[model samples]
Target chain A: MLTINDLARPGLEPVNLEISAGEIVAIMGPSGAGKSLLLRAISDLDPNTGMVMLGGRAREAMPAPTWRKEVGYLPAEPGWWAETVGEHFQNWPSQQDSLATLGMPGDCGDWPISRLSTGERQRLGLVRLLEGVPQVLLLDEPTSGLDADTVESTERLIRDYIGTQRCCLWVTHDDAQAGRMATRCLRIEAGRLAEPTS
Target chain B: MSYITLDYADLAIAASLVLISGGASLVLRLDIERRLLIATLRMVVQLVLVGLVLKALFANVSPLWTGLAVVVMLAVAGREILARQSRPLAGFWAYGLGVSTMAVASTLVTVFALTTQVAPDPWYHPQYALPLFGMVLGNTMTGISLGLDTLVTSLTRERAAVEAKLTLGATIHEAMRPNARQALRTGLMPTVNAMAATGVVALPGMMTGQILSGVEPVEAVKYQILVMFLIAGGTGLGAILAVLAATWRLSDPRHRLRLDRLAASRD
Candidate 1:
């Protein structure tokens, strides 16, 4: 679970929200609406004037790696760290399920990274994040390159992962993905964050 | 060879180019003025000094001066490599050792063990030793600098991916192996490519210089080949050492990445 306050960027006013464990909060906005900015702010990759509280302690007061281990952040484009996919899962315990949930075949892990499609790498990247088992997951355009089938499967994987482990803040523009994955939804309009309930 | 006498006309010609370029640079707009002036001034000052000192050393013909010059050149090259990395003094040890060892080992073997004669006066001639050593050391220094900067910057940029691995129990090496390999490959590519394309595609500057100095083409080719190998050996050693040197602190005893130990970038 995480609480955010005064999380604003240049030429933008502060906005706030809270997310709970096992909850999927989909953030939707038009292009340039700072949807990805919200996730990056939580991840400590981008500095801003605000506080991010994971569990109860303020992220500002916690060590970055400690907070980061508790909160896994994946960029839209995942960076491949090695030459093979099996190498990606060799240390991961949730490897089989994460891969299967993302609609990846068991032997998909054996392919050389250079031979992989972007969508495949993205799916593997999601598995890598899940392997960390952080208390909070921040994803930005995570399934951008995935096919409709893979996207559906990836959304399912994300939902399943949140059901099993932690809070999730997913950023996407697709109305279908929002409906399928989000327990609650927030839309960023004119650079401000809001929950539909509020 | 004996002392090289200065022809005032040749001096005038070199000086004229520098001055004309420097003066032309003064009237130029922002971006290139300082660079032109600096490049011109550096060339003029460096060549003039090297010429004067080399002439004296050749006339006096002392082994001590020659060796001292070689040491000074190595120190300069070493300092340049460290400056580019710009980390604290603590981080430069392995780089210093790496560059020095590569430079000394390659030069000694090339000059003393193989060449048999540099100047007919003395086989261990300083004029040849100092300049050749400087050239090899400088290039390898650049190789280490490029490799180190790329590795450190990319490692920090991809910290999240690395941390994901670490939390999955990937050791520092395993986490960084990807970035480390990329940087190493990029660093070594220039040296490897140059060696591969030598002679037909491009004539190396050392070989060209030897030819201009009236050395036989066959002899020049042999020396060029030797120098290329020396560069490969030194650069390979320096690049690998620079990576291991900077990343020694990637992990703490707790087995987590000690991100804060990257004092250069953390600031």
Candidate 2:
């Protein structure tokens, strides 16, 4: 289980929550309501006064890199460092399946980042994040810029990934998408998180 | 081997060069006549003030006066660095870091040169120490500002990508490695170009000054070479320190990028 205790950051009210193994929690809020900031705080990317524990291991107990590896976050606009897409993932066995499921060609790995469209980059970024095998996924508007077909495929891919004893906290502004993906829903307004509703 | 001395009349003749340039601009309708004149006047006034201060300083060389002058120069240089930065640190750290780096690096390099290379009579000889300090400190200040500015700019521009990397299990150092390298390169470019263009393209200011002051060409070249090396050392040290210090300040103990600490640069 992932447990957050009274997490509070600037421009964000204190929040307490929990997600058991294999749970998918969708967070919805108005723009600038600290949705993204809350995800950042839970991932320990921003300064926050609270305790976050995954499976009873405190986020602060381990080294930051180690903690981040287990609790992966896919930002809205992903960062690609290397010239080629293949450079991001290193010898992961699931690469073929991930690419194929996302409707990306096998040759997509060798393609230059400059050639990839925003949608392609977004899908590829998900593939890159999943190859790391994170225990908890903190997704920030994962399907914002993608087309309808790609969005459905991406949602399917996320659902499949979280099916195997992992968890996720997805931030989205769309009410329909939230209802479709979330096992439980939480809303944020004016910096406060409301109680979860099934 | 004495060189010609320029009196007030000769100085007036040399001032004609500015009028020539300004007149050309005016005749061509380039619209820079006023700016050109103002810039020329500022340069002349500033140089004259510096010359007067140096004359008094060289007349009575004492540690107290020398130190005071160095401190004042550092303050001015620190402000210049702060002003040039688009994304300065939120508070005094913006100026403090640059000043401290320049001060530490320039002082060390200058003292080392004095003790080992120049070896003037009293060691704190204003003539040698002050000029060397000025050269080293000035270069170091520029290098540090460039380094700091580049790092901050990159951090702000690539915030998403950097955060993505951080969330992917990369340490703060790992995430910022590329930016740090680029910042170092940017900082070192000016000194590297100076080194490359020194003898062939143009005579450096120090060598030209020495030659005009009746020093042998070979002797002047030797001094110029020494100054260049000292400057390179000071600049490199200041640049590296500035980047490292910036990296440290912009992150937290938990290895998170503290973007709040940065003030958006007013470019």
Candidate 3:
């Protein structure tokens, strides 16, 4: 289970959230509803006035590297920093597993990330972090770029992966995507969590 | 060497020119106007005062005074570089110490060990040591700034990526590898560019000064080569030292980038 309390933003109330083990908790909200901010807080990308506990221990208590490794975050847009695909994997083996799981052939290791189509980059980013095998996965708009067909493929892939892993918190804007991807759905208005009636 | 006198008229003109330009700059950039104005005022006053002091220092002919003067200049330049370049004054002393060591060791190696001996003449001679030391310190200051700027920018931007890597069991160096490489290349660029343009487009300051003072063009050219060598050496020493300095102070024992000490202003 992943538990986040008071995550993101000051002066606003502390956000409380939980995604049970082996369940997909889909988060839906309007623009700037702290959706992506949630992913960052879990990964310790930006400091938030709150606590993130993955598994049992408080994430803040352990070093951030340990927390991030245990809980992977895939931002909406992938490949923000590294220029090439090979560059992304700095002599690490998890890279090989991620590339393979994303239906990429072995030689994809040599491919430059810029050459990858949008779907490929997004898929690789998710799979790459998963190769690290974090117990909790934080995915933000994992399929925003692809067409309907690719979206289905990504959703199925994530569902299958979560069945094997502990949990995944998926963020999306589309109602249909949330229903398709999430076992339980939620919405945030302004900055407060609304009941996931849908 | 033929001596050129600095007349009172030269001093007065330089002062007036500095005041007009310097005062206008102060009025225009007011938010951090104090920094610019004080730095400009300090530069003008310090250069002229140092020039006069050097003249007296040379006349007095004391190695102790000359050595002490260089040490003072190195300390001041090191402090300014560490302070002016980046934030987190907490790490300033560590950085200052590292840069100062390179500046002194490199200057001594160039003046005493490398130069052809005119022993007594070389000791307090503003002609030989001051200019060489100035070049090394100036480049070291710039190098450290560029290096620090690159590292800090990368640290903030790639904080997530770095954390990701570290969790993957990469050690601190492995985690910081990409950022470190980026900063190292950016820091090394100025010296590389100077090397590329050394002879063709640019007439370097020291060589130009020598040629203006009636030294033969070929003779000036020889000194230019030596000076260029010294500059490259200084760059290597400063860049290596800066990376080492930043590595220790930039992170906590937990190996996390500490933003508490980093200045709010990106520049």
Candidate 4:
């Protein structure tokens, strides 16, 4: 479970929200609506005034690394620091199955990062974050770069991963995808969070 | 063998080298004629003033004047570092980091040299302390400036990548590790290359000066070697410290990348 209490930032009005385990909440907003910024704040990747609790543990109570590991944030464009894909993931052996689920080869770790397409990177990004087995997932446009088929597979993997006792806050621009993935829907309009009008 | 000092006429004759370079720049349409002239003037004036001050200090041999000279040099170096940064730390932090790095690095190296190697009758002897400190400080300043500049610029350019790591359970240090390595390498590369190329490719300034002043080539080389090692240490320490401090300044306590901490540089 995740709880955001009075989260407010400049260009973003304060709002409260909660998600129980295995619940996927999709947030829809227009450009410059602070959607990505909200995700960043929830991940504690930016300056914001609020209280965020994960599994009854306050964000302030735990160290940053511990919090981040438990509450994984998969940014729109994942960062790859190493030369090869294998080097990026922490536990390659355990995560190999996750890679296979994303239509990657078992030895896909040997592939140079430069060879990975944008879609591949995004899928791999999701896989990398899931390998940590986070309790809460703050994903920003997780399927933005994927093709139609790949997007379904990615969604399936995500859904399978969030089977139970896991919360997800997904930011999506696509309405159909949002409907399919989200159990609850919210809209960000003029810097404020609200239930979708329709 | 005492080398002859250059009289005013001798100095004027030597000044023709600048005129030649300025003339060449003008002919080549480099458009740097004005810069060349201004730089020449500034160098001449500053060196002459420093020369006079150094002469008085040498004659008096006081620690106060020596300390003052070192402080002034560090202040100037700090300003240079601030001016060079593309996205400097906000407020006093920009200059404070530079000054502190230079102070710690140059002071430690100068003390090490004076107390251990140089071992002058009075440890704070102006001649030995000032010049040695100046060399160490000057080189360390460049290293720190280069390293810190690379870090800030790289962090800004690669913001997404950095945040990706941060969100992946990386500590602030782990997230910026690559940038940190690159920045430190960038800072230390010049000195490392200089050391590598010292004897074969180029005769260093200090050694050349000593040799010209009639010191034995072997003796000058020994001194040059000592200074080179000292400079390496100071530059490496300052550069690492500067990058670490700058990185810390650019982040918040909650492991966030805060670009707001940086003042928008007027390019």
Q: Is the docking of candidate 1 incorrect, acceptable, medium or high quality?
A: incorrect
Backbone clash count for every predicted candidate, in the order shown: 0, 2, 3, 0
Best by DockQ: 2
- Model 1, range B108-152, lDDT digits (tens) per residue? 544652365344446656666666666667667777777776776
Q: Write down the worst ten-residue block by lDDT for model 3 chain B.
A: B113-122
Highest-scoring model, TM-score: 2
Candidate 3 residue pairs that clash: A6-A14, A6-A15, A85-A113
Stretches off by above 4 angstroms in model 3 are A5-13, A48-51, A58-63, A80-110, A189-198, B1-50, B59-129, B150-172, B189-233, B244-267
TM-score of each: 0.57, 0.95, 0.67, 0.93
Give per-residue CA lDDT, model 3, range A58-141, as digits (tens): 976887667777877787766434665656654545465545545666677667766888788787777667667778878888
lDDT of 4 by residue, A106-169 (tens): 8888999899988889988888888788988889898898888888988998998888878899
Per-prediction TM-score of chain B?
0.76, 0.96, 0.75, 0.93
The Cα error of candidate 2 at residue B88, in Å, is 0.4
How would you encode candidate 3's per-residue C-alpha lDDT over B96-208 as one tens digit per residue? 54456557545754575235642335555765677677787777667766777788777777776775565453556777878888887887889889989977888888888
How well docked is model 1, in DockQ terms? 0.10
Model 2 chain B worst lDDT window (10 residues): B258-267
TM-score of chain A of each: 0.87, 0.93, 0.86, 0.96
Ranking by DockQ: 2, 4, 3, 1
lDDT of 2 by residue, A36-103 (tens): 88988988898889899999999989999889899998877788887888888867445998888888
Worst lDDT 10-window in candidate 4 chain B: B258-267
Query: Which residue runs does candidate 1 get wrong by more than 4 Å?
Result: A7-15, A47-49, A60-63, A91-94, A146-153, A189-191, A195-198, B1-49, B56-136, B145-177, B181-267
Tens-place lDDT per residue, model 4, B42-154, is 99998999899989999998888888888888899999999889878889998999889879988999999999999996999998998899899989999999999999888
The residue pairs in collision within model 4 are: none
